[model samples]
Target: MPRIDRRSFLTSGLAAAAIWRPLGSARAENFRTDPFSLGVGSGSPKADSVVLWTRLILDDASAATSADPFAPVPKQVAGPIDVEWMVAEDEAFSKPVRSGLYRAVPEFAHSLHVEVKGLQPGRWYFYRFRSGNAQSPIGRTRTAPEGVDGFRFAFASCQQYEQGFYSAYGDMAKKDLDLVVHLGDYIYERTYGAGLVRRHGAGVPSMLYEFRDRYALYKSDPELQAAHAAFPWLAAWDDHEVTNNYATDRAPDAPNPAEFLARRRAAYQAWFEHMPVHPDLAAGFDALRIFGHHRFGSLLGLTLLDTRQYRSPQLETSASDDRPERTMLGPAQEEWLARTLGASQAKWNIIAQQTLLSERDTRAGPATGYNLDGWDGYRAARSRLLDAVQISKAANPIVIGGDLHAFYAADVKRDFSDEKAAPIATEFVGGSITSDSPSEASLAAALAENPHLRFASDKHGYAIMRLNDRSAEVDFIGVADRKQRNSPASVFQSFAVSDGIAGVNRL
Candidate 1:
């Protein structure tokens, strides 16, 4: 057998044995607590397959936390451990459907990425993992359909570990949502936000182990854990996953390219280990592929984007900002999006990217201010994407995002400055899960200045979108009080987009 590199092994498939490790080195050690402390999750659901994930965190391994010295460490695994996984028609595993063995090795952080294939289309299944005497929590996952049918999913972003509680996930889990799309900021790299009901329990991480520790801290939250066990999440990241306000190869905080790319490599690898995404996504930092498309029956087509990975530096708000060369998704991703969006045949097309797709004028009076980190900074790039939306003629193309930390529903105008220009598509920007939102004064100005924006909220929450052949309805579900452990999630606002229409109606 040929020896495959780690990246090559992952890209080829979830063959843990291909990495070449001595199975005899693996030993049986009974764990007092659940070794699967990180919880189980599934993602990348296709009509016949879905990727399942879980990480083995032995109680005696090593210190995964630096901020909290008292935190317990994990037990080290000397060799490969075969984790038995089973999928069934019932949660009890009485009617087992698929069974497999995943070789877990410490080289990949003892994380298992099993791509279970041959599942029935448009159906739900229960799955669990077992290794010796230890067992993982049962997780629920579903496959996409091959025909026209209604699909329901929720998307949220900006979950800073130190700023607020994860009651949003707790509340969202009770909603019985079919799918969850996290648009970025899954973990905060900084600790500067105010009103800390919880802390990251560690310092800023720049190394592989440090980043892994940061992820371990977030995964310890029971609410977050329950949410992951409830539904498979399509996860993406913005700046906070690495550092604040970073744009591609340019790190404003770290001027040296070598230093920042090293940190970026660590962050990228950690994200792959924690997320239940495709095996190819963990190839490497240089060729990591997190951007892709997922379809739900034939009613909706979702395009997951990686805007932060290959964007140019945030330019100053001046006439020079309109440079035609400025790119957000980069040339390759832009071309891919154009080709993919142009060919989409779903009843409702959803462009799932980080940050608001529509323009927002922040300054109250004559002075104009735009978030250079968003689409406003790259005018020509936004125009080209809008052109693709126009040319593709996707019916009721709706953009959903969550980097702004506020709720917004607007008509995506070809030209934000022009009112008479009919809307080419609609957008719903969900508020942050627990991260702080823009102040009322700032949001008030944003709403008043941007006439295209129909609704705005400063609450912390996510967006639940229901799609069908006739129309698509989006409910902005907000957490009543994230500071409270038992925060209630309610529909802050609702809107609808008729089939083939280019505008939204407030519901």
Candidate 2:
């Protein structure tokens, strides 16, 4: 067996041996038993435990094929894989916290996900896995704090695999954040734009048939992999993860309803495979992964939303009447969010979502029509979410987003129509990892037009958010340029969302 010698590889051998138990009593030679594995990971952190994951890449891992190529067709197993996981306080493993074994079965694509529990909160720990005599690489993770004292987190989104470079990830990785919030559009299905302005390798998998292939292509990116290995991530997806501008029962330019639904299920399954997500919560056919809240003790409660799964189709006529029945997060999820926000006891309530919650009607170009695909298209739903924010009066409601490929800060209001509408929340929009740079001239024009927009930038990068008892500062770090393969980044703009005020002022 050969090892890739890359920093990401786990181990050169598998530890502990188990008797061979071939499928249906098949011979051991037929099944895969690759000793040199790809490696391991951890995610979905609770105060006491976290989920550790890994995939046993077989020597003859099946190649992409016509009908669901990534699907693992059963081959006779060489033997049962003895998998062991360990969590320790230090990288040297002097003080081990937990150690255990799990069987690596072919049914799960030879991957292992162990939810390790019984640990102290607000502490950093190192973890890894082992099989037979082989051991995996050491990964660092942290447990959430129990109360609000001081905390720092970075939020990002819109990482198109083939756009240009992952300078954004590199920038975010250096910030030393406690956790990362990926709002949505983690990967784009459609080759996205085209030409130089926007171009990916190929269209992403719309169905399960190509989900694994797409994820493999994405995971292969060194920057993305580095960022993942560097910290624990809380992620969600937007329309591009499955299809462009996709809404429930509707796909961009997609005609057939049944075929589109099948594609959605496939994409969702693939997303689960590649991401550090839990299996129990994966989206199934007709079932949507919508709104959910994560409570970080009494410090912060982060709410992740799925706007694409239940949104009403963007209106063609664009009338106020279209607002009555339309929604971004269907009535049920909307209610859940309201109750969750109103019920939250945390000092900071963060909404991690796909698009700008602020009214972005003043975007630079021709007032040609708003991206009906975004909140601008579902005015009523946006209003509903904002109304909840007002009613709940969350300690400090902050909406973080990443879809438009630009950084923006706006004071969310009860009414976009009322020039004097009371402020309900604060919004911080992040730019993309390697997407097109919206024209600067347009941004300047839009800035001049929209009074609520305190800050806006067309640069490509991510935001570093630090929250303390006093204020939450957001640094709009911008990269040198994404056209090059390796570009360094710097802070272009910075703003702070005051602790008690619903406003963002330049820092």
Candidate 3:
């Protein structure tokens, strides 16, 4: 038997190709084991293509064993597994549009990333994976529409499995959405807090096995799986996906930079293995380019930003901490964003990012304070992005984010402190899917101090955005209780951002 590292296994190309011979006649008998335990997902949809994903989970010992426990361990499969996939026009898979076979190898956790193409735009399709006799759950996906008038999407974040159930996803799954935007915090790295509805099963993920296992545990949830199967997802990562409040190559509490980078590498690999993202986004261990734009005809343009991986280290902020050198989106990404916003001719330009872009002062005095981890810490960068929006004349620029675990509807003004400066955009910070929130009293106080914030709610839920040529209506949906499974969710508040308006109006 030969041993190979994960990177080599993935990048070897032709070297590993010889090992992927067809499974042949004995395929059904060999693949009797259920390999689709992690479920299936599709993402990065364009007008003609989408990526389909599924990992072959061939029993716990074969897939989960690790010698270092915290390091990337090679998976041991019986052999190169043959995966079959199909895209159809209906749930029954009667009208087949595309079908193909992919070789799932152990180097990449036996996961298949099939980039299917030649599909029509603005159309619904059903997809599924098959390995021998075993079949995966069917997932529904859509391609970006060209020249469409409207589309609906739901944005969610901060789903800490232990804190509560994924009931919000259940409700989201029921909605008719063109896509689902997961802003960040898909999984928490460490476990804390009391009253955990479910445990992460293992300790904080520092190595490849731990990180992979953690993602597997979260993906095993029925509700989360349902949401993934419901629609194609556009995802970005915040701190928790790697570690709490991690910025770029640095982890604040880590004693050494080398150790933190190693952990980050492991987390990035696991995230890539599980997500239905495009293979082009994979940039080895150091980083993954998760920021890109998705166009829905001429109606909407969604630019997903990666704020965590390309930011300066967290800073302690005071009234005078705003500096030009401090950055959230690194120079290249910043340039890319500015160019993208400038070029977008859509009716609405949406910045789907990870943290609250608006300033939120937590202190009791007139002295201004800001969260060191959010955009408030990178004041100059936020200003530059906002200025780009204004200079580009981007139509109906709306920034949607999730991180604070509280819902916030605010006007992104040219200057948050200056009442004279007209608003440049609108921002809606969705509440967490299941994570806990601060006290309502504290949220109220913050809201009162920040008049730019039109509404604030410390609850557990997600947001539904209905976009059209005229306006974008956002319903801030809140779950009754995250601790309870099947907890009902309702619109806690609704706001509309009309075309050409840079402010949110409560409805």
Candidate 4:
């Protein structure tokens, strides 16, 4: 094998070069067509390791495209099969740094999650999986760096399959980015909307196989596959991953606790099967906690939260649920966050979670209203996080979230009722990938009622951030049109937050 330059692996052609590759002449098994059509992905980056993932298309059960996303999906079980995977210093697989054989099993839908470790920190690596003569797409991933002068990443969420196309992800695939953070609502459980560009059929997922079929339908998209293959991602779930408006063991329509828990269990199992999280995460399906912290050297600390799993039930009015005992992060997650914040010495601290963090008054005129489904319903819980930041003196705290189907920029205040209070941190909520947003009339009223919310948009897209030692710059990349596939996207707005600033300023 010849020496390969490490930098050459990260050039502009990174995504294109690996876009097409014939199967190697190693024929261990034969298939009628490409079995790697669903594509490959990686996540959970560490200093010496990162997780690589791929699901084999062993049968034609999930290959057919139906008119509805929820139409009954075919199912078959066959796995405990051998899969060969390698992480190379170059895209050519010439300088193999780590390689192994992973056993794909039926328990996890034949999905492979290999946490390859002992890797060089902050370096780009190419990976792929092979079964017999079939080769998966070449995916690019990187281990967390020990240090950095600058870095760029994007955060997005809420891609409703039937609502629109995945052009946002397609646009992201062409950009240079180290990480991608998906802030939940990966798959909508039910179909409910108007003027939808597509259809999810006429059903909602509930059972394990139903959920698996739903995932197969979404993952089959080529644009989504390309984005997954381009960069490492940190993903979490929200209400839709299970059902609409479901809280910790509670659902508005689910009158029976036992039945609800069973549905949630299946949802959790399916989420674990489809996501590229740690293998051990599967152990906590019943406990309803799926959150963790990651670091990119001294530059940044990221805490991915699970707001839907262990949270209090929904509140219709913000003031109705401000009880001192109402919790959002739950006690354990809150404790972990506090401890993590206290110990973090990074210049930038980020809370990547779901929904809006700052208060959003949905009413107009001299009246106070709040979206209790958010921080408003659990003011005390929000206070706990803020208190932890203040007590720990966490540096440059910033919060980015989704689920609102709109973009929002706000300064989270120590006290929202008091306009004179100082902001404790800055918050940015990126637009939904394809989900619909509130009416223009609703957004206008929201802006008028809440002066703290600097900006909000109903357009669909993602948010890109470039961070350096001195500041973090963000751009709202909006899709020009989502009613059609292959639509164009561009940055319509930009904002910046200086190192010591506690608020976002329009750039």
- Show where candidate 2 strays beyond 4 Å: 1-40, 59-82, 104-108, 132-134, 194-204, 282-285, 288-290, 363-368
lDDT of 1 by residue, 148-178 (tens): 5688899989988787788888887777667
Q: Runs in model 1 with CA error above 4 Å?
A: 1-27, 61-78
Better of 2 and 3 by lDDT: 3
Q: What is the TM-score of each predicted model, taking all chains together?
A: 0.91, 0.86, 0.91, 0.91
Please report the TM-score between candidate 3 and the true structure.
Answer: 0.91
Q: Which stretches of candidate 4 lie over 4 Å from their true place?
A: 1-28, 60-77, 316-321
Ten-residue region with minimum lDDT total, candidate 1: 1-10
lDDT of each: 0.83, 0.71, 0.83, 0.83
lDDT of 2 by residue, 82-125 (tens): 56677878766667888777676654455566778898887888
Write candidate 4's Cα lDDT for 385-438 as tens digits. 889888988899999999999998988887877777777898999999999888
lDDT of 3 by residue, 1-507 (tens): 011111101234453233333445634423424678777889998999999988887774643554556744444455778787888888766687898788887767777788999999989888877665466777888898987987999999999999999999988888888899999999998876889998887788888888888888998887888888888998888888888888888886677888999999888888888899987655586877888989888998999999988898877645556669888999989999999999998999999999889888876567666787888888899888888888888889999999999999998888888866667899999999988898898888888788888899998999989999899999999999999999998998999998887898999
> Which is the better candidate, 1 or 2, if ranked by TM-score?
1
Compute the lDDT of residue 303 as modeled in candidate 2: 89
CA shift at 110, candidate 3, in angstroms? 1.4
- Cα RMSD of predicted structure 4: 5.9
